[model samples]
Structure formats: C-alpha cells, structure tokens
Target chain A: MTTAEITVLNKSGIHARPAALIVQIAGKFSSDIHFARDEDRINAKSILGVIALGASHNTTLTIEADGPDEKEAVAALVEIFQSKFSS
Target chain B: MKVYSLLSLGEKHKENFSFKVLVHGENRNLSHATMNRPGLALTGNFQIFSNNRIQLFGKGETAFLYQEQHNPGLLVNCKKLMQEPVPCWIFTHGLFPPKAIIDLADEMKCPVFSSNLSTSLFAIRSNQILTDEFAPRGVVHGVLVDIFGVGILLTGKSGIGKSETALELIQRGHRLVADDAIEIKSIKGGNILLGAGIRKEVAHFMEIRGLGIINIPHLFGTGAVRESKVIQLIVYLEEWTDTTTFDRLGIERHYKQLLDVTVPFRKIPVRIGRNIAIIVEVAAMNARLDNMGYNATRDLDDTMKRYMEKNK
Candidate 1:
C-alpha cells in the first residue's frame, strides 16, 4: 500500500469538479484507492463519497492505495490536490 | 424445541386478554404450539386424542356441559377428559366452568384458566406466542434497518462500515432495528425470517468506529428505532479490491441465507467516494420493487430485446 498526506489547496476545496478529476485519474489505475479525512476514509474513485466528506479548502487528508499499481495511483491523486485541482 | 409453559400463557395474556387463573396445574409445561379444543375428548372420545396440548373449552363445550347437566354419562365423560394428563385447560368467552368440572380439575391437580376474550381471539393470541417460542432462532453480526417499510440487513466484516452506513441511513429518517448483533428467527417454517436486537432493549444502540457505543433512540428519537422487522433483503458490504468482480447489471437475483430462510442479497463494493448510504437506500427501494413483482433490470432488458426484434 502507498500512503501520502496531502492538503486541499483549491479555493472551493474538493468540490464536485475536483472530486470528479480525482476519480478520472483514480479510475485509470487498477489499484484500490481511498482518501481519509479524520474519522472517515472513503473511496477516491467514488465521487459522492468524497463530496460527502465535506472536505473543504485547506483540509488535510491521507490518500492511500493498495494493489499492483498502488504507488502510481496515489501519486496521481496527490498531484490532483497539490495542483489546486486545475481543470 | 422450546417448552411453551401454561404459566407463560397466563402471565403474558393476563393484562390484555383478561386471562384469570382459576387453578394451577401440577405440570405447568405445555408441549404443543397449537391450542386444541377438547370437544371430541369431552364426548368420551379418547381414541387418537392429543393428551399433551392445552385443552380449550369454548362456548360449544360449555353449552354441551350445560345441556348434559342431568345425564349420568356426562359426569363419567367429564372425569375421563380431565384425567388425560393434559397440559392445562382454558375456558373462554367469560364462561365459568361447572362446579363439578372445577372440582375434578382441582382433584386432578390440573391448571385451569378463564378469559373473557372470545374463543377464537384467545386461540389466535396463544398461537402467536407459542409459535414464537417454538420458532428456530439465530444471531447474526449485522445491522437491521427499516427503509421505506422494507427490512434490510447490512452484513460484512468488522470495520467495513456497516454501522456507519446504518447510522447514515438512520439520519435519512429510516428506523434501525438491530445494530452489530441481530437476533434472527425463522418464522413459518423458515419461509420468513424475523430479525430483532440481540438483547431487545439494547438493539437500538450502535458502535461507530470512533464514536464508542451510542444509543440511536436517544440521538435520533424514538422514530429512528424499531423493536423487530422481517428481513426482506441482505446487503453485504465488501472492501473493494482490484480482482474482485461486482454485480454491475443486477439482472440476476442474488440471495443470502438467514436461519434457513433465503432473502434477496446484494454485495456492494466499498469505495472511497461512493455514497454507500444512498446505494443502500436505493437497494432497499429496489428490493421493495422486486417484492412488488417488478424488476427494472429485467424490464429494461425485455424492452431492449423487443426493440431489437422490431428492427430485425
């Protein structure tokens, strides 16, 4: 499993669009990916689960993935958050 | 096999059904789930008689006893009926037994009860209680919730979010039946499975990962919890893995066996962004639709097939 602590940098936080971008990237990989916020660690590939987290701007989350391509999957998701979720 | 005692019958129905104890039997245990009227036995017919059941003395038997008040053979038949070592006797519809019959019951050390409830009502109520006592029961580690009047049992390994998902469902106005440990019973010979909280009073309490043991009724009010429910569907939440395959089409029905009863089943893959509560809600609604004899997946498939045939 690959784990990385990342902070939400976008002004709007990890809203629908940013969540969708994370899913788009996470979907390409075969690894099982999850994003943890405090007591909740939800599937990164699931848009609603992420949005339900209410992870607003500057919220710190832990992204973890396990499977054959865990490293690549985590890196891709981490990049999405660090890049300010740019379209 | 559970023993349905005559003592339980009187105590349980005493308040609501006005069951009054006239005499206490030497044998307080009842061996049958069904109550039988001893009209045939009272007529001096002991052939193929069930001597181990609760003898119900309704209006017909009481009327016969009155009608045979002057007959010498009447005393003999009544004595024979009371000596069968039967579990107990109940006189219904406010009819007090004849003094002679009560003396015979007292002498035989037989328990006797009288109730103002109609004979049929008493029979039905006794049957319900005895059936519950004799039904097969089991305990399952899951959460039972009532969604849209449908009882759904959420099952999976520990930390798979069964409680968390159930908590969300409760927040959505659904009632929780049992959390963590659900006591289930196969009713009607395993045709229907009824689920309740393990200890009953503690069934509404839930344990969320970080939130210790929280009482659902206290947190969400009385409307958020139910004492028991008939399990209509079972949803298994499995941790999503790369190689695992999930039911995408939902065209074919899947089932989970609970106490030898089969219930419609679904295995939902747990994903980070997936709103499992919504999925569970939809699954419950779909189960309700399925119970109503409608399958959206099959219906849409049939529509597509007909459309293709027309094009052909």
Candidate 2:
C-alpha cells in the first residue's frame, strides 16, 4: 500500500470537472486507489464516488493505492492534486 | 447526532409520535443518545442528573411545573434545568410548557419540542430512533439485492460482474437495494446489518461498463427497487480457476462479518457460461430454508447413515 495527502488548493474544490480528472488519472493504473476525506473513503476510479467525498476548498484528502504499481499510482495522483487538476 | 436530524426521525411517522418544534436551537447536536425524565431534577435535586440528555417532561412533570407556576420564584427549577446544557426539552401527551418556561428555554437557547404521544410511548419510540442513529455503520463495495425476500450482497473486485448479476436478478423480479457502494449500519445491538445506498439521490442507479449510469426504477419501474434491506447473505463472485476449491455441500455454514454482525456467506466462481444470477437466487432460497431449520446436506447424511445401519 502507498499513501499520500494533498489539500484541495483550487478555490472551486473537487467539483465535477476536478473529480472527473481524478477518476481519469486513477483509471490509468491497475492499482485499487481510494481517496478518503474524514470518515468517508471513496473509490477514486468512480466519478460518483469522488463526488461523494463532498470535499470542498482546503479539505485535505488522503490518496491510497494497493497493487503492483502502488507507488507510481500514488505519485501520479499527488501530482494531479498538486497541479490543481490544471493539466 | 444533529438535534435537527433527530427531530426529523422523531416526527417521521405521524402515528408513532407526532412532534412539533416549539423552539429551534442553533442547529445544535444532541450531546447524548439517551433521554431523561427530569422527574426528581425538577425539584432542585440536581444530584445524579444528566444535563447532556434530552429532558422529557411527562404528565407528572408537566403538572408539577404547572403547580409551581403559582410560586413567587416562578418555577426556578425549570429555569435551573434549562440553564444547563440540556440539548432540548420534549413535552409529551400534547402538553405545553407554561409561557414562562418557554421564554426561559428560548433565552437559554435550548430547543423545545412537543409531541402528542403519551410519555412512555414517546420515550420508547424516540429511544428506538436514537438507538438506530447511534448504531455503528460502515460502507462496502458491493451490490445488495432482495431475492425471494432475502437480502443478498454481491461483493468482489471491480468489474467482476457484481452489478451485472444484480441487474439479472432485477430482471427476474427481484428488488435492487443498492449498487456499487452499499452503506451498511448494524442495529438491534449489532444483531442486524441494515444496508442502503450511499445517498437517496443516487439510489436505484447503476453504473454499467458500456452503458454508463442507468436508473433501475426508470427502467424497471418502482416495484423493481427498494430503499433498504437487512443483509441476510453475502456472495463473492470471483474468476474461475482449474485448481480453485469450492464448497460442494452446504453442510458447514460460512460467515462474513459486517459491522460485528455475522451473515451467511458463499463464494461462487464466475465463468462465461455460468449463470451467476440463478446461483445467487438459489443461495438466497437455501438461506431461507436454513432459517426454517432444514438442511438438505445434513438430512441426506442422516438418511444415508440410517440405510447403512439397516443393511448392516
């Protein structure tokens, strides 16, 4: 398992478009990735699951992935969060 | 629990205990899960009183408060009780607190509620709601379906056909409780595992591989869906392997624990030609039969033993 944390820096937070970007990035790897906010743990590959996190601006989210490419998957997700889903 | 949310649960059923909010607090939380009568505490005996609990003023307490209305101090005990951080005050039997008391409660920023149910009845119903609200809950990646009135949870790796099997069951007149991610709560003191969808807005909706999001109720009507159900059985759908071992007989029961509740469990191998829907249905029926004290495998073993003894 690999884990990393990132705060929602964008003023818009993880709305529909950002959630879609997360899901898209998460789908690139075979690892089982999930993002947890508070007590809620949502599958990152599912758009609805990402939206269900209900994360708003400044909410810190922990990304966890478990598989052969766990470390790479976690790094990929952190880069996306740090980029604020811009690219 | 949010006191506002608690109000919604208490007044959900009009017949059980119809509650009316006399004063709404600042969306405060109910600090405690239990209720208190405030019987002795009304007389200034503050000795073992739980100020965090919601105080219920029953007939006796109401009458006592009314009689104290004539006192020169103007019911100081009520004022004293309200001064504490009591989450709220509930008056039963359609009784209303004196205007003085209500004003005092309003000044203290304590919520006040009234219900038409008798004291004991309201207490019982609210306690039941509180117990459920405070129960432990968890979220599982699975699809819960009701077949033959049995709640069967299908769980496995993503894209392993849990949703596909559930769709087939729904086609066969079974009900879909939740799909993808099922939110489960254990109630009845951890004896019952109640399952529901993550949210009501997204319930009865499924995400298919190629079809995207589809509404079951819209596709199959309201009869094909249910809000929630007790998870009676769990089935894990996995890829088939030549060397994998499977349970041939239902003699030994397998259990899967959810929120501290044990539910009958089974693992079914998935293959191209195999019909997982029918297998799940049969599993549910078998569970129902087991509940009726009948075990086909055990019965067969006993019959075989009897025949061998007679021949010997």
Candidate 3:
C-alpha cells in the first residue's frame, strides 16, 4: 500500500463537487483508495464517503491506496487534493 | 411461479369471498396479480385487452354489453376473448352473466364467476388475496418487531432470549409484529419481505421463560402490536464466547436470506451487563442511516487516517 498526506487547499474543503471529483479520479485506477482524517476513514471512490469526512480547508488528510497501481493511485489523489480539487 | 387453477381457487376462496361459479373452466389457470375490466374489448376494440388477467364485468360493462346486444361483432369479440386462454371472467355487484357471454363461456369452457360485492370492493379484495396466494412464503424462527419505523427480526437459538429482548423492546415503545414463529412472504418477486404471525390468535402473544404467554396488545394496548410489517433487518443473538471473533468495524455488510429474499443481518453477542435492547434500537436507527447513505464507520476511518498522517 502507498500512503501520502495532503492538505485540502480548496476554499470549500471536501464538499459535494470536490468529493465527486475525488470519486471520479479514484475510480479510474485499479487500486483500492481510502481517505482518513482523525479517527475516521472512508473509501476515496465513494462520493458519500468523501462528503461524510466534512474535512474543512487546510485540514490534512491521508490518502491510502493498495493494489496493482497503488503508487499511481496515491500520486493522482495527492495531486487532486493539493490542487484544490480543480476548478 | 406456481399457478392456481380456477377450480382450486373456487374451492379455496368460495365461502370467504362469496365467489359463485356461473361456469366451470377446469383447466384454466390464474397466475397474474392484476385483474382487468375489458370495457373496450366488449365494444369490439381488442387493442388493449389483457388476456392473462382475470376480466371483471361490472355495472358499466354489463350495461355496455346490453346496449350493444344488436351488434353482431359483440358476440364475436366475446368469443375472441374467451378463446385467448383468459383465466376467468367475474361479474361483480351480484350481476348475472349475459346470455351471449355465458353461452360463449360454456362453449369455450372458460370459467365465469359472480360476487355480491360492489365492483371496486371486489377488485380490491381479490387483488389482495391473489397477491398473497402468489407470494413466495416460508416460516422463520424469530420475533419480528417494528422499531423507529424499521422492521427488525430477532433470531437466535431456542433459549437465547429472543422473546425476552423483544419484550424489552416492546416496553421501550416498539411494536411487536410476531413472536416465535414468523411467516415471511416475499412479494413482488423477492424484492420485499413481509412478516406476520403464524396464526392470528397467537400473533401478539409472546412466551418468556418465566412469564408464560403475555399478551402484548392487551398489556401495552393496540399500539404495541402490529398485524404485519416489511422486514428490513435481521439481528441474530449469539452467546458471547472468546473463540468467536465479531466484526468490530461494521464496514463488512452482512445479509440473511429468507424466502428467497435478502435482508440486512447483524450479529450481537449476548453477554452480562450488555443492554441488548438499547443495542437493537441503535442498530435499527443505524440501519435507517445506512439506507440513507450515511455510514459512521466509513466516516470515522477517514478521520483517523488524517490524524495519523499529521502525527507521522
């Protein structure tokens, strides 16, 4: 498994749109990816799981990925989080 | 997918539903849940005639047939309907079968039945009876209770306190559906599970070890008991043991199969000082939340990983 810590730079944090974007990106890879904050963790590929995090701006989150393309999955997720989930 | 022959249906529900057979069609089968009124079909418009459904001839249909008696095409249309393997024809409101239709039915060997009930009432009652008759059914050893608008079935061994927990739950304002033997029926092709007591006389009664056969509705009033409910969750009580490991995270979803239908299942260990009733209540509420797409375990997992990342 590959893991990376990334902060949410988006002003709205992980709201509906950004969560949907994360799910979209995470679904592209063959790896199982999850986002963890505090004592909670959820599937990165699930929009509901991402929205349930309620991670506000600047809150650091851990992205974990495991499977055939774990490294690529973690890298792509970290990029999405650092880029404020894109415009 | 079993079909009930018209003769068997006539024998089974004759007394209760007041079904009077006008003509006997021995080989005809009644399989569908829906009944149709072939008003347009009688007018020689066979475009939307549902041949598989049981046809009903009410006041309006009978009047139309009587008004159209002079039309030669009317008998032809009636014959066409009877020849298409239709289950049976019923005349409601104590209406007698018309001469032409009865003659065609007799010749075609199609079943014809009449009832004293009004058109709307007979339609509604027949629909319910047919749906129940055709539902996939099986008996489950459990206590079904309605908690927080969710139907939960409590299952366990013979002496594992299933009824006791149900009694406690009822005391907490939940409604008991069935005790000991639950009759589970899968309606709509196994998409739903409807539960009821095995017998109407013993429906709301429960048997606790020390307390023999307590009447729930009598003790707690009618609000504490329900005739039937759609089972949404199944909680199995097990004796706590060191050897058997349980699911601590609640991420793995479990399901139990009843009458070819699958329902959400949970295993709660019965141990000292553990309030099983409260756990069951919480489980019921949690099931509602899960259905609404809010899973606490998954949310907590996300939060924990973030904390770990910052500390590392």
The weakest ten consecutive residues by lDDT in model 1 chain B span B204-213
User: How well is each residue in B1-312 modelled by candidate 1, as lDDT tens digits?
Assistant: 466566766676577668887877575677678877788777777798877787888999888877566766877777666664578888899887778878877888888888899999888877776777778886666789999999999988656888889999999999999776566889875699999865665577665656555889899999999899999989999999999998889988888777678888889999899999999999888887877899988999999999999999
Separate DockQ for every predicted complex: 0.02, 0.39, 0.01
Clashing pairs in 2: none
Query: Which candidate leads in TM-score?
Result: 2
Residue B184 lDDT in model 1? Answer: 85
Error of 3 at B19 (Å): 11
Name the top DockQ candidate: 2
Candidate 1 C-alpha lDDT tens digits along A3-87: 9999988888876688668867988898878777654456675444555556888889998899999998988888778889876
Best-to-worst ranking by DockQ: 2, 1, 3
Clashes per candidate, residues 3 or more apart or on different chains: 7, 0, 20
Candidate 1 vs candidate 3: which has greater TM-score?
Answer: 1
Q: TM-score per model for chain B alone?
A: 0.89, 0.91, 0.73
For candidate 2 chain B, which ten residues in a row score worst on lDDT? B1-10
What does the lDDT read for residue B223 in candidate 3?
A: 93
List, residue by residue over B39-142, the lDDT tens digit for candidate 2: 88887788988988889998998888787646645467777787646778889988998788777778877778899989888888877777787888777878
